[model samples]
Target: MKTKYQITTFLIALTLLFNSLQLKATNTIIEPDSDKDKLIIYILRNILTRSHYVVKDINDDFSEYVYNEFINGLDPNKRYFTQDDLKEFSKYKYKIDDQLLNEDISFYNLVYSRFQSKIKNAKSYYGGLLAQSFNFRKNENIDVDYEKMPFAKNENELIDYWRKQLKLSTLARIQSKTEKQNAALEKDPKTKVKSFKELEKESRLEVLKSMDELYYRIEELENDDWFSTFLNSVVGAFDPHSTYMPANIKERFDQDMSGKLEGIGARLVQKGVFTHVYELVSGGPAWKQGELEPEDIILEVAQGNEEPLDIVGMRLDDAIKFIKGKKGTEVRLTVKKKLDGSTKVISIIRDVVELEETFVKSSIVEKDGKKFGVIDLPKFYISFDDENYRDSAKDMEQEIERLKGEGVTGLIIDLRNNGGGSLKTAIEISGLFIDKGPIVQVKYRDQDPIIKEDVDPKVQWDGSVVLLVNEFSASASEIFAAAMQDYGRAVVMGGNQTYGKGTVQSVLPINQFTKFDEDLGAIKMTIQKFYRINGGTTQIEGVYSDIAMPNKYSYMKFGERDLEGALPWDKVKRANYNQTNSYQNFADVISNSKKRIAENKKFNLINEYAKWLKENQDDTVFSLNYKSFAEEKSNQEKEVEKFDTVFDYTSNLTFTSPTYELPSLKEDPVLADKRVAWHKSLSQDIYISEALNVLSELKMNNTYNAIVKH
Candidate 1:
């Protein structure tokens, strides 16, 4: 549920540079030598330079940043482009800024052309390397710290690099296969096992197949895709959140923002040569059909009564084209079931799939004989096209109403891993917690900061409130959490700090800048920086938690602070807002939580585990020898066993849906299953358990009680 980027669209009028209104409307067909790329670059440079939140000079430093970003993006693993190739590229290292100023793509052209040849050469290297059996008995190591490792010096060294990489991949597969065989033998001594040589041969063939699939997908990418990558590098130079989306990616972004898609409703991921069903969208056509399940590999796809087209080894995008069709259309899929390894042909109707998980959902939990409501907000989602479409704020309001009807005493708004969406929704949701106040301050380039306020004076939930956040809770999530924290209306809990992403982005249609009918895609540019009502910005220094909890990512470098080109933290004049007199002993509650966390053995072990994970992440070197690798893995497993009780520590809490949801659960079995699974997870979650404890301990002040009575 991690979102790599956060975006929010706002209305803006752009002055068009081009006036060719009579140009016939057509899809923009970008080619290797198309002038369209130049036009795009020119438009982007003009727009970003003028309207971006942080106006940066496109100087030598900017050029160097773009250079590194583009090169690393293309060959992050140092698998292609040797030191000599980089030396050749150094000529344009400081000239990219000049190239953009002149709308010259000489650097991009050279790199793209060289990269294509490198891909072709590397394909041959992998096939030949995988064809031969790897001698894992060799005492060697592969350093996976690619960022620190220098590129290969020559073609021979590059090929040797690929050989080592391929060997590592094959070794992993062989080891996994060997372990499985051993496990089977342990279960029933009659199980026949393959020899070491046989396993090695099988692993090599598997690696070869995967390599073929990788190259196939790479070859499927067009000149436009590579150009888009280069363009994104240029945009990313401005900030980490700002991006240049090609037409296809922009279309997908729209779908994700709307949280609706017309398809079979099963998310698919390409693994090797097969498309595996990642997850079935709840309440979707496929989920309703009940045959399609996660991990089921789709072998072939067919239109109604049409010949089945084998999608094996096909690019995921290409396969998706065949699987997705017009609404109400029939699509048949030949799938291999993961549960029993049985193959079956399942027919599904393509329809508008409203992703249920994207919306707000709540569960009632009983701890210490008190009922509390837990709301898991994935993001601050909203559909700009459909006004009536359910947004997070609207859904959240409804869910709160439902929970209140069920007489829940406390509320926990779980914003963990919520990477954020609509800014309007965040403010609206914040309004639900407080009567009315300034939610956040937005500062545009060379402009005075404008305070975005919640004018609504009606409070939805005045009881004890808790906000759960992590390093992944970012952007609009930060805005909402900051607002609540500033108002002293909720207890913020989770990681040390939330994901620091205070920048605001608006998706500007590139076609609007031109009268040309060809769709030129859109650029999601950082337009503004948001500040908390408390005068602090959530940019790099995200909202600090009231009660910092131990999590897997606590000790790791993550969130906006770790991202390259991230905006810096700042502060502004605090907004005129009143802190709520909701709780009697807020500081005492926080102190008690800290005391409990320190004394808890589970939390101590988790902290230890987090440290261990950080240590493991830092150590990227691995032994290539089979015996050494096996020994290392055994040692890791044994070390990991010391923290096995972390998962086993379950809270004795009961979670259930509201009474109104019970009938729907009975009607929709899939929904029931989802709720059951969610409830089970909540029951086992130590975070939620501690939150319940805090909620129970929180004493509502006389002001809150008087308001409730009134």
Candidate 2:
């Protein structure tokens, strides 16, 4: 006897499975060999050298960089290799360039083989150490800062290093388990808590289990993955953004950009050895079937009539590859329910999973009797393959019109953590605030700068505009912010500076240049650089905010300036453009905001938190002794507790959806809940409260000027 949910799911899955078999497969597989490898290297080098913004001669220096970079990428912790291994590999320090030109991959093979051999030895080293009991009372510490440390001097020294690492990990786990046990005892007075010795033994066993799983997964790595890393190292020497994508990874990237995937439409994350359901996509196959829910642990996955494959202990990526298939395909998942832990096989038909969260959305915020809009644009998303696809520019325009219908007096475009996307969308979106102007200037290698202009004369919202940004706001985000600042269209506010990614990359497929059946993944090469309308390039020096705000990430190095081989900041001739002069008291308002921030207690707390975070980041080396370690953690926790009020600050504001979205509350409860949660977050955001104050000041100044003119 099957439940209604199970019957519905199976019927859908069976119907889709038949349809999937009838459709023609588009992808063809090719084996990696010397001929294909030579073609890839040849095509990549030729394209990059000719089209890259900054072309470098493949000489001895470049070869040395590639050698060090590849080695460091594989074993960044100074593990897996000894001093003797480094010495032997030093011979190829300046020969990699010549070998690449000759289509030679012998160097990669040599290094990869050595890494595999060393990793095998390391497995035995950790196994032997974990077998014995660790002394937590030992007065010893391991310097976990691998960047400053050298490679192992000998095999004996390497084994000792592994021993300390394993011991430190095991000790941390033991302390964590003991604390949980103590908490459980406190909660239930009659319950008997496990002793510290018993907890320690259990923690050690758990750590050993996790390590065994990790080592097994490492051993299962196919040659294609390793070769992809090596090829990435070769192209990465040119720039950080330039790289090679394996065929499978390329397919996923394409799906991500399009915001669609053919799968059961459930977000999964690995916890320990099991894959748990995080969220089900709205209106997706699994969501419609309705049996799958959040926190359900998936034990096995089967395709069509195949035997279910146990996914426990399998890597997340590998398991996902098995679960996701072409649309109309049938997949069955053996899921263990979260509440009762009862297992059931739920069949689901694969459909296109549309990621709705990636799109632009707006909320009407009312503060101090004045309604304003906050447009949270996550990315400048657009699909190049689909010309009719919905993009950020179009979505933003629609949101603005909807907010206008709700009678919003001001607007705030929040681009925090928005690592940008489509360049065309950024240009079009910038034009919405101002009448018309040049948005950005692009310069290719030895070519004239191409000025991208928004020639439209229609100004959607010229009143009280504010742009919010943070360190993660990059590329197209920087372009939009910089355009607004240069034109004096909006008051840009947030962290010290945005992420400075001004270079443009074009993904060129290698198969297009060769006759090979292999779908050799594309080379995403940086082809051009972009500059602000005012002539400054946001290459390494990103756009600065008009009103600077302090946060926990203020002291961290996350911008393009922190990346190696990043392009330098340079200025070109300024484009002919007129400023909007939107704000009448821009200078005075900025000064007043600065004064208010200086006096604000919450801002002061943020500054203190930033300093504390920096200090803790710098102090990486930790005491291995349990007592000292406990004391250090306790003191840190006490210090953080002092700033508890920082998160407690909430504004006396209300947020609501527009009239058009109101009916959806009754139609779709899930969407209604999401909107409710989003609204609640906005009402509590301290930064947004301050932004409203800024908008009020702008509006008041405009009114004052109008009275004086009359």
Candidate 3:
């Protein structure tokens, strides 16, 4: 007789044996062909079925998932598609799996065609609807719970739906204009206030212009773009993390992972018809030039001394094409400043802009005369193209050394909103805290779990540590936090739990698999699942906080468990590791923190605010009548005022950069301004204040008395 592990393995093998036979049958149904779309489907189907962590069979259930995902992707708000279109599209609801096997694109083609037609029809509907004045005085309400909303029955009903949406938009604008006019008149008795009729007409024109811009962007999408959307729908059925990326998207994804981009060093966002500068990268060329600022609208773009090309009403992507150029190239932008509504031409030399926010940043704070260090890691970033390039682990180690030089007693590693990056860096970072131990266990399909250990014996920071995390802390972040928590190395503090993403994905180039000349893009496929060293998987049940804190997302459904089709949480054999037993009074420290939080008025208010947010999120119906809408808006503002003190709360601690960074801050005023804003925000962060308190209470064991020895 076999042992339990062997028996379980044998059963899994037997199930896969049968599934392999079905896969073979499906493989015989279609051979790789010249058609790119069908070829992509073939490649994705094979890769997902064979290599994915969870083996989901291509059956009616999978087909239904793809169908719903595609339809929802096209018309999420149930705006464009009518019930008749859905009915026609539902014919292939259970046939998608068969179509995939047969290398057929009939369903996708049909849906895409119908969606295009609906978009065209919607343009006319919005234009006609916004041209006429909306009778906001009519007593009516609109339910915005679009997920459960039924599609319109006919063309007339569809037009009526558009009318309601446009009416809601126009009503909001009218209300805002009326309030501003009233305030102007109140401020100055001689102020010329526009009449209700004039404001209403102005609001309609604004709404109409917004709709036109939206339709123009929609019309700019090529057939390949829509096809990519359909392909993503198919791959997404396997898991939420698995996705298909076209060539352009893959390029941007690479840039994001590398935390570098070649441009004017300003982030842009399209509003109405113009692209506005959202932010300037600190220390970048634009920031150095000191001409471009956030909220400045780029009206036109010119290369060097060439004639300016008007970019107003241009597609944001098209505008970016003109704005971004090779390094050392000059690009002049005609800008409308947000400060004084003044038009000015600013020229700047483009260069490689490093996104400073993507890396590790540390601040020193003094609490009761004991200096504590806070490291805010946005992501576990790494440059995959070059091994010698900067990574989070190296930066973290250097920052720890600097803080140690500063004689800081305790350290807080903030991983809040850090959707994790490199797994290598996470393991390396974990090693900085512990001498040597297993960090995480990776398990792929049909293979024994492999334990990834930190073989390094040197501990970087042998002191009291506090790890801060929120619901957005995921993947590599969760792994590092879990390792520290398991080893009793740090006090994990944050929301109830983390983002609960335990799976690993590898981006594979589609062109590599085939002899194709064109760039076929890539696929990010989930290949493995990670488990904590203690044998518990951080799949659905993320690493729970040792000391839970109240946050705005506290009562929200934001973790992986809240998502559909997430992998089930399971365990494997525990990896061999030793607990550091570093904290002497860990239990007492947690108890004291809990007691203080229980009586804290601000925390209680935050909890109440979280509940109120949940209530508002659940309420989707709104009155469309002008009088009721205004009253509801007034009531909301009044109610929101009760929570206004949340922003006013500040800690007594003072945060500053390390001595090494002071020289750079003095050189770059933009960088100095950014640090000032960050320090200000940290001073107002109640969570960090609590973390510092916990850090103060923690007492290290004599066995690990490195910090005390220093």
lDDT winner between 1 and 2, please give it.
Answer: 1
Predicted candidate 3 versus true structure: per-residue lDDT over 126-216, tens digit per residue: 8888888888889999887777888899888888888887898788779878988889989998999888889999999877876776678
**Candidate 2 weakest ten by summed lDDT:** 1-10
lDDT of 3 at 448: 88
lDDT value, candidate 2, whole model: 0.77
lDDT of 2 at 478: 96
Model 1 TM-score?
0.84
Tell me model 3's lDDT, rounded to 2 decimals: 0.81
Q: In angstroms, how far off is 623's CA in candidate 3? A: 1.0
Best by TM-score: 1
Q: Model 2: which residue pairs collide?
A: none
The 0-to-1 C-alpha lDDT of every candidate, in the order given, reads 0.82, 0.77, 0.81
Tens-place lDDT digits, model 2, residues 121-226: 8778878878878887888888876777788999898887887777776777676666767788889988787776777777677667667766687688766667
- In candidate 1, which residue pairs clash? none
Residue-level lDDT for 35 in candidate 2: 63
